[model samples]
Target: MFLLLVQAISLLLVPPLQSYHLDNAFGNPESVWNSLYYVVLLLLFTGAMLIIVRYKVNWLIQAIMAVAVLSTLVYVLFGLAVLLVPSVDPLIAGGVSVVLSLLLTALLIVYPEWYIIDTVGVLVAAGASALFGISLAILPTIVLLVILAVYDYISVYKTKHMLKLAEGFMDLKMPIMFVMPRRWGYSFMENNKGLPAEGAEREAYFMGLGDAVMPTMLAVSANAFLSAPPLLGFVNVPALGCILGTLVSYVVLMYIVVELKKPQAGLPFLCTGAIAGFLLGCLAAGVRPF
Candidate 1:
């Protein structure tokens, strides 16, 4: 349910986000430099996160993450408000965005409840995915996905630093991870004892925000860049294929988590599924799969 919710919200946000031209750091989506730039930025972010965690500066990290969340939420909300009220003034939209994002930030800072964290996590994932999707063209997006998938694998399976980072973030109760409790009685705030042991029947399942955001980025890119006719009002055939592929992979990843009872790197499965589905979609749509 959490996976589906995030993907659906992301798909819904893409068209409006594109309308507002909310691309990040890289302006020219087609440039190889764009991919390289993003790769570097991601590495830097990971390093910074690890350093912050090592230093036990969780509050500082939370503040930075909150600011980022607020900025992205403002972008998404501003775009959505403009779409809903086409004649709305930019200043009015900006004010609405600011107020809404600030309210959300406050809720996160104050309550930090599981439901609130999950809800805000979904919003942040959608907004960030849409932003990156619009920023990178097909080739760059694919490169980004593939590279990140590999990095995720190395971080999870090899270095295992990602696990450490997750532990730190979980302690902060920030929206960095999505919380899906197995039972309604689960409380994330009280349950900060770290992840369950391998093969353990856990009280809840946790997935990183990147796990949800990365695959959706491909869907958003396809919707923005592909010329195929819309199969569902918001997305083209290729984008729809990407979305379906992601959900399919999510099922498999969950099976590994639930049935096999293991910790897995989600992006490896998700990116592969999306890329394969995207290629098939491109073939079906009669577009070059480059």
Candidate 2:
């Protein structure tokens, strides 16, 4: 439920971000090569993160992630501030965004509570999805999703390095992952000591922020690039289908998680569902599925 809500909210932010021309934080909008650049950058960052974890340079990784989180928050917040008050000065809005982002980052670094991490994680995920969604067109976004889904599968199942990454991230308690407590009394700080015992009852659930961000990249792109009439006032038929499909897959993913009590590669199911839903939506809307 929480993850779905975050995805929906991220989708909602797309049009506004597009209106403000705030998407594509990292690439040239006119070039078809942007997708390739993005993929390469992603791989490089992943390698860097793995090296950071391998070397136990927790503070450096956390600092790098904090800067990323702050920048995205400011991007989204500045756009939102301008949208709410069109006459507001960009400088003032930007200053406010910086301050807010700084405070949020401070909270994450100083306190590092589960709820705080989750809240900030959602905002960062939303901002990133919106940015990337508008940056890439349909075909490129599709390519990105397919590549990421494959990479996620390999990282999790074949190499199993993703598991190591997860363990390392748990130690930092950064907003890179969302935390869902299964029990009333759960302490993220305490749980960070180590991975859970194999057969022990888990006290909380953890899902990568990427799982929410990736499918949402498609939803935001659909909303931005497709001209289909709105199916429900806010989203077009195709985008809505993508969102619904993701939710359906999420339900299935959760079922497997709860039933089997094991870690799963979320992007495989999520990306597949999103792509299938997108194609179905395109068909219903009489748009090309490419």
Predicted model with the maximum lDDT: 1
The lDDT per prediction is 0.83, 0.82
- Cα lDDT of model 2 overall? 0.82
TM-score of candidate 1 on Cα atoms, chains taken together: 0.95
Q: What would the per-residue lDDT of candidate 2 be over residues 1-290, giving only the tens digit for each residue? A: 66676666666677567766777565665465776787799889888989999999988988898889889899877766776787888789889989999999899888888888888888888888888888878888888888889999999889988888888878777748888898877879777654565555678888998999889888888888889879666688898889988889888998988887778899999999999898899999998855
Clashing pairs in 1: none
Model 1 per-residue lDDT at 227: 81
Candidate 1 lDDT, 23-140, residue by residue in tens? 6547788886787788898889989999999999978898898898899889877877877887898899999999999999889888888899888888888888878888888998
Model 1 residue 242 CA deviation in Å = 0.4
Query: How much does candidate 2 score in TM-score?
Result: 0.93
Measured by TM-score, the strongest candidate is 1
Off by over 4 Å in 1: none
